[model samples]
Target: MKYTARRTWPEKSKSWEYLGESESLEEFALAFATDKALEVDTEFVVIEKAGAESEIEFFKVTRTSPYGLVTAAPRVESEGSSTDNATTKDEQSSNDGGDDNYGGVEAIAGAWRGVISNILMFVKAGGAAFLFFLAAIFLAKWLFNAW
Candidate 1:
């Protein structure tokens, strides 16, 4: 799956500007659009392209802070199938009564990434501090022996 990020400034121009593309929506959202742009006058959309079909999802900026803009649930708008024989009974039956849980799984994976990164940072900091303390103790012992 490919995701593309686009933004439009209605006041400036009606045309949408392509920001970039990524393999995941979370990466695209985290890479594009600053807090100021989301707050001021920009409208953002993420285009999800899968095989022959594509989906355009509009994002609503819910919260804007120094970090970035928090988006509400995206409004999904499908562009329809590209091929005539796209729909089949088998496919329809497979999808019937089943909720798409990709978004949920992606969110969980993203949260886990944040937790793991924080843990790695803490470990690195602690290791560095311990090394510094060891070096200080060694230096103190050397100085006492010299005296």
Candidate 2:
């Protein structure tokens, strides 16, 4: 994903200066707010090459989740053709539903990602706790049975 941070100058005529690229959205937002920028505009354009799948990819859901919430994956529009004029929000989500799924594969992928991320964090913390427990047991044995 490419992100450009620009600061606008309001004089007799409005002008914009490109402030280089930002690594993250948080960084871009912070600079826009703190720098007293006149206008902060984000340009979003999705371009697909000659041969690409229009549908979004899905990910498997994690079975053991603390929060029982299914995440949705982001979708890419292969059907919608681009135009010079601005695109409406209504046109974007207006996908002709062929099935009963509330959201397509993208939504499923998102849910799975969330579940996996949580599971990973739990495993990391649990691993550290287990190590500490083993150390305590070893210390206790050494002190009591020092024959």
Candidate 3:
């Protein structure tokens, strides 16, 4: 079976960065594990094909907490036209500039979400502190009364 290694960063776009093709799965796995070119948060998939006209199999490669790479089981996809399904260098380049507006909007939204999350975290901490202060005051008052 022929294995093809491809990577894509979800935060960037859906375009796949084709690494290379190999006949050995071990070679692809080794490269996926040790390749410095691959980004840390990006995803890698190995496409397996039995023959030229067979169904394509996709295996996702993920990094474990121990910094080791692991490949998931193959997920079979239906065969389609080569030109329609394939992500060539030319196609990737052409699609890059077209999505600038979409990416900008996504970035703005992400930033706003992050800000809101930080605000909520601070509010939560402040609320907890206020409750703790009230509890301490009540405890002090009870101790004074008993004395």
- The lDDT leader among the candidates is 1
TM-score per prediction, in order, is 0.33, 0.30, 0.32
- Backbone atom clashes (below 3 Å) for every candidate: 0, 5, 0
* Per-residue lDDT of model 2, residues 13-73, tens digit only: 1233323345544444344334433322222111122245422222212232221112234
The predicted structure with the larger TM-score, 2 or 3, is 3
> In candidate 2, which residue pairs get closer than 3 Å at backbone N, Cα or C atoms, i.e. clash?
59-109, 71-111, 72-107, 73-106, 73-107
All candidates in order of TM-score, best leading: 1, 3, 2
**Which candidate number maximizes TM-score?**
1
Candidate 3 runs further than 4 Å off: 1-102
Tell me which of candidates 1 and 2 scores higher on lDDT.
1
Q: Residue-wise lDDT of candidate 3 within 6-122, one digit each (tens)?
A: 554333335444455565765665565466444445555655555666433333335534345554543333566445544653366457653435556666888899999999999
Arrange candidates by lDDT, descending. Answer: 1, 3, 2
Q: What does candidate 1's lDDT look like per residue over 9-71, in tens digits?
A: 332222345456676775666556552255543457767766557766655454455434445
Which residue pairs overlap in candidate 1's backbone?
none
lDDT of predicted model 3: 0.57
